[model samples]
Target: MSNLLKILLIEDDAIEVMKLNRAITSLELKHQIIEANNGEEALEILKKKEILPDIILLDLNMPKINGIEFLGILKEDDTLKYIPTIILTTSNNQKDLLSCYKIGVAGYVLKPLKYEEYVSKIESLLSYWSINELIKV
Candidate 1:
């Protein structure tokens, strides 16, 4: 991966976003994070960008559009399908997991309920992506 890799985070919860930002900032991972409230907003941001994100951390539940539906649309687009997407959601339902995988998500992470655990998980995810084979930077 390159030193300038960027992460797109699609999450609706304000507290969760804050926690993710704090955890990522604390790590100094040489990654820039872009935020979106929901999948629809995220799609809009993506449409305007010249370069796609190296990784996407997507939440399952949201207001405008859910993660699985978003993934369906994203994968169908030739420009977006190559970017690896990781599902990060509070829901651990087997059906959800299966659906995410079926739609070709690169990874699935169940949100840790506790703040400390959440930080840890997010940090670990960043680290994993940094060393992942699919990453370009």
Candidate 2:
């Protein structure tokens, strides 16, 4: 794994975004975070091909193009499908989980309530991805 990574975070909640930023800062990992308030915005970023992300942290519910819908489009795209997409949402619905997996999501993680728990989960997730053999764009 490389020392630095580019991460695309598609989350609408401001507070959740802040929390995630804080967690990443605490870990002190060399990473660049590109944020999108919704899936549509993320798609635009992907289309630009300016900065290809090593991983994507996606939220399920949003104003436009929800996570599942976005995943469906992304997985069908030959170029973008290779990048691992992980669901980090508050929803624990069984149907949501099953649907995301069926669409080829790398992981479906429930967002923890506690700040510390959130940080721990983010840390662990990042650590795992950083160590894994990811395909280079």
Candidate 3:
């Protein structure tokens, strides 16, 4: 990979987390993944800012500050706003999509039911981000 990413994965589902890890390992990517159980936890990680992530993979339906709320918070912060945030979610609701886009979410992707499809989406998502010229803080 030309640009290995430090990805912040904010997801509440344990199974989803495992699946993402499995996909990365299967793809043999060298990127690092930092996981957060929910949006609240993700904020704590971001607050430290020890090293901001290259990209954020967020889930829409999470407990304690859902994706929309989290995006609103993140976009308001000058420093954090530049970090690309992509929604990896099961919700393809039009309202949800509009809200996220309005809040300036970088990307929105619906989770596929099949694992193979899921892997394909993840691969594409990572591939795009890995090559893009990202802002480094």
Q: Output the number of the TM-score-best candidate.
A: 3
lDDT of 3: 0.96
TM-score for each prediction? Answer: 0.90, 0.96, 0.98
Q: How many backbone clashes does candidate 2 have?
A: 0
Compared with the true structure, model 1 gives a TM-score of 0.90
lDDT of each: 0.86, 0.92, 0.96
Using lDDT as the yardstick, the better of models 1 and 2 is 2
By the lDDT metric, which is better: model 1 or model 3?
A: 3
By lDDT, the candidates rank as 3, 2, 1
Clash number by candidate, in order? 2, 0, 0
Give the candidates in order of TM-score, highest first.
3, 2, 1
Q: Candidate 2: where are CA atoms >4 Å away?
A: none
All predictions: root-mean-square deviation over Cα? 2.0, 1.1, 0.7
